[model samples]
Target: MMFDKVIAAVDKKLERFDPIWQAENGVGGQRDRYYDKTGVAKWREWRGVKDTMVDYGAWLKNLASMAMMVASAPIPCLKGFWEYRWMGSYLGTFMFIDRLFEGFRGYELVTAHKCMHAIVRSLTKKIAFCLSNDRRLGGGKDTDRIVPMDEVLPPLFMMGFKELVPFPLQTLPEFIICDVDQHIEPYYIDVAESFGLPADVCSRCAAETGVALDDAFPLIGKAMISTNMPCNASEATSMFQRRRIGMPDFPVTLAMIHNEPGAHPYSTQMLKDAIAFVEKEYGVKYDWDNLFKYAKLMNEQNTIELEKWDYFKTPYSALCGIAETLYRLYAWASVNGTDPYFNKVDRQVIKIMRKAYEEKKEPFGGRTRHRAFLWGPSAVYYTDFPTWIQNCWGINIVLNMDSTMGHNMINTEDPDEAIKDLALFSEKATMRHHAVGGWDNVNAIWEWAKNFNCDMVLMNDNIACKGMLGVHALMEEQARDLGFHFIFIEHDLEDCRTVSRQDMRNCVNGYMSVVLGEEPLDPTLVEFDDSDAY
Candidate 1:
């Protein structure tokens, strides 16, 4: 399921990165960006050619892009109007706009990566198309050139290389797990077992491995770039995939910054060579200047996100629990810095808080019955359970490990600093965060959870991940020391076949109703035998 093109009909009408489309929409401008006719597209500012160059023509063309989006939006919006089933898809359209202006947050972060890329590309195309309508500069003599989609590579098909290839995941359809989760996870997971990947291996890794070993997933790129970030499984899968695809794979072994103090510096310098390797692979030169510019934007994004996080610390936030977690993933986890949407969202958050404070209103009716925090990944068993907790039980989840662990800090002054910062921060993100030492992650999760006034600590346990299972006692002890109510749930955040949605709902319902002495059962959850597919 190449969801990136699920809405291709609408996408074709609003071509991204093509100038001709914008001109047709009446916003015409210049074509050629004469400053650097190189493979990497960038503004004059990126070349250290002074950031003062006024591109009024580009502005004029963007007006046309805006106009085109408004005029063409009804086509997509109509999908939402038909029925409630299309509602998530319809709301997804709005989420695209939301992400367009505010970057990742809400539905934008929690949905499939292909869906995320599609949404972002849809905007980029509109803007690119609008900019392509240059009828102004030098009598519309030049046009901004973009690597045509047909010619574009599948971005770094793995996580670690994104620092060099900006918006790496944005270019491909991640069908292995996300867009086609139900069909792929269930089918490929079994395939993984059949292919001799020990059942004890992390299911997430096994899923990716099985797909690559059998060549089940789509071939977005001939080559793959991956890392041994926190486990050997990634290396094993990436190696097998490289062999299967008949292309060389570039894999980096991540360093624990805490133990290896020079890890960030060494990794940053190495990534420069890594970028060159990528350039050779894709036959495209690395945009070093543009990299710094993107870092600046990412730095700006991180700054605003920290400010946005402060809102949740208030007695109650309009940014409730799961919604907060969703936005957290959106702002910090994905392709955030490439656009101005994040800054716009950051500013909008200030307005939201200001209005809330002025009206003396709480995000909840009064106050949250319990201030909660998730130590592992957010729950996928029930997509709406977090919202259910907030409205029905008055419990608000303000923090989580997946989105917040490596996001506490980042640097953006220049290429080197930003690279080092990313290396350091990423070392502390994801599964790597907990691998620093024995029970170190347990304490860290508590520290951050407590920092945000989280009194109730919850975890949606992945039964298949034996590593976390080994640390359960330590995590419980830490929670007990902090005087926090800790609840560990058995379910996979990405795979629901292990535990059904109703099964989890009953578990959570028991905790909130019976354990916490809250209100009566929500009665909202239903017995969905096949909830995973939903």
Candidate 2:
């Protein structure tokens, strides 16, 4: 049921200090000896002697020893030596980078630890990879040694740590449940049971109760029973079979596109249409232009040049962009789906919002900020990829998708097939999905969304097939009770070019209007019409 073994391993080792930690905290005071005039002179002389050497191995060894000393030194002393604000901070940065690179490369912890030793070795290696490749360095004869720690560290750290931590843990929970709803009650109960907790104790109990159930007691009872005991003996045996053989063959009817890089004009239009529909239906006035302006400002602040909205250039920047996009997408979906739940769960939120706004009373009867207490669809989830690049650079673009619709989509469907489509989109920009039984596999997604407080679920309605649409309708109804903002955008997985510039603007603007309570702006003003542009 749970990755208990992995959790146990992490829990056990989490408390133990690595060499870096021990060196920083325990041996941080040894830097004075190195800082002394004599010590400085000795190091300088060593550097001078090393610079004159033609032997690469000797140079490498010397650097390795120095790096080892630096890595193993007390955190405070290391800081003073580097004249940085904090020694521990510097070591922490290096260790983080080392771990991240290791994770990105899919190295196990032990393997990563060993690789850290190798990096330390390379730190000492005088021949830089960059220098090795430089024609100006006179091919292999160049003796110049340099360390571009900054350039190398970020990608390594960014990629490695994400890999080390399974995608599910880092991003799940958040995206699975955008807003709470009735249809997802069973899923919530199951999750609670998995954690050995009572369903009543689950965070979204309020929403789950909306479902027509014979008795709430059974929910708690089932969870309690499942907690301390395994399933029946036959079921346990079946579990093994399930683990080894997986489910029966099911045709994939839906294609999930991953990392669909091109302009998202359709997404933009969908958002606009959704906003217009919601506003007209709900009688809510919004400021769409202002919202888009804010989005543009945010994009600029994050250094995402609208002119260069092609493939994500850097990992960090890519993550930032993805996070922004997913956040807005989720917001739009939740808002558009609000009509379904308008008389049900959403009214409760509105009541809360009004009370907080006018009466200054908290919603959910909590003392948190008014904004914090205003609940909607929100959860965290994770995604997986085959290659390290997909895992690192590509996946990060939607790091917060779990907190968005991405999590819900995966949970509701065959994750393998969904992932396959996602990957295809990343590589070739195409996707397809096969059905499982009568369900759309997106049930998992809906369940997760309900857990998170999503009343309306947002999904990528690429094909709009009957089965998939049925799933959406069911989710929409459930969201009405749970109070979701449901919305879906259409686009082909294969055609990255299908996402036009206008679509991107409309999507961003419309989503912002819904989430931020603004108007839907005209996408025509955004100038996304250029077809030849990236």
Candidate 3:
């Protein structure tokens, strides 16, 4: 009885530090949950009893997915863990997920988990598939059935090859893993530098080159397809990768300034040539029926995506932040209508979004002080920046530049028309259109912000992105003229070693506190050490 009373007394005294209580009052001491300088929280965040149960259930679901990954190919997965450095980095996934949706509740909580679990389930399956067939891990029966392709290329069009699995090769070793564990890529980057690659190259490109040089990528596919869609750096890295992999590779160079009508024919022909190359190498005919089946799925997914954008323009979107961007990036680029599961997830999420809108419930319990459009490529290392900003400040990230990738509806019938549509869609791939396609595309940020009804633009200034380097003054001047609140959050894209997560937060902290003269909703988040954290 005395112990119970003592516990109650202490809880009452420390109510200010209780995340659940602080959440209700709109001034959370969220930092109290963490041990200093680490991602480790002393306890799981206490959403109210109901939401807590939901969160715990979601955690269990993810655990099950991880277990299945190991079970699918026990020996291969074991070998993969031992042979691949990036595979071990996946151990931080649960922690990374925990941090992704820290302050979520009610509809947002449920919606985020639905979207996240879809990715989680899909990723685990992909990991198993890769490990099982990986030639590097003692090639299985299905090794030659894989068609390794550039991660940036939308693999949707590759569905025409019904017999083969078109895998985004770099996604396993470099891209997605970087989002989970920030420290993993730095070693690869160092490997590339040691191999005579300059240190000043884009970290994304450098890390990919390093992954190639380190021979960490799974050996799969009879022939590989590389692309020059996103940038020159990516093209350069493709050369390095092609040499390292020693595979018969075809480079699909899409037109850079792709918006012009003239560029379509060139890009379409390139796609046709690439398809021909694949058909010749793999000895499999292209099947339009197979392509159309997946095309319809992509079309419906995109239609729902457009409808979701309408909700984003309103103040009542159930989905926002990393939950919105990360899912779109993965679904659009990686999965790309290849799976029916994502479409089902999207349907469920949209229903919840509609209900939330109908109820007029805003995310973060209506504490949103600014509805901002996050422009430029966000830091992969700090994927939860959106969640952090919402919890620490009242700024709701309404949209992200990456999410604005190719939404054009493809023709569900007619092979010729569909090929053209695919080319057009592929032209606007992630970071390709906005970051490096042309000056007009880069300058379209203001129009996008206005269309989305955003009051502020949080421009991600990737310090080493050569494409965006010279636009700093122009963007600032334009923001001033347009009368929208803008702040440039600078970070080295894939390399947190250059600009730490704290440095990125400090960028927003200075702008929020000094310029806006607004105090943080959770002041404890303003300055903290997560440098040593996963």
Best by lDDT: 3
Q: Whole-model lDDT, candidate 1?
A: 0.47
Cα-based lDDT for every prediction: 0.47, 0.26, 0.89
* lDDT per residue (tens digit) for residues 465-500 in model 1: 655667778777877787998888776644556665
Instruction: Give residue 139's error in model 2 in angstroms.
Output: 27
Tell me the TM-score of each prediction against the true structure: 0.66, 0.23, 0.96
Instruction: Output the worst ten-in-a-row residue range by lDDT, candidate 1.
Output: 45-54
The predicted structure with the larger lDDT, 1 or 3, is 3
Per-residue accuracy of model 2 over 1-534 as CA lDDT, tens digit each: 356576546544632222222222443211121233111211211111122132223334435655655454334233333331112222232322221221121111222223233333433221132223222223332211111111101111111111111011001111122111112333434543464543222222222221112111101100000000011221232232223232221111121221233323332332234334434433444443333332333223223222112221211121122223323333222221112221232223233333334443321122111110011112211111111111111212212222222211111133333333222221211011121123433444445443333333345443312334456567657656656454444422112233332353344345445664543121112222322211
Window of ten residues with lowest summed lDDT in model 2:
220-229
lDDT of 3 at 398: 87
Which clashing pairs does model 3 show? none
Task: Return the candidate ranking by TM-score, descending.
Answer: 3, 1, 2
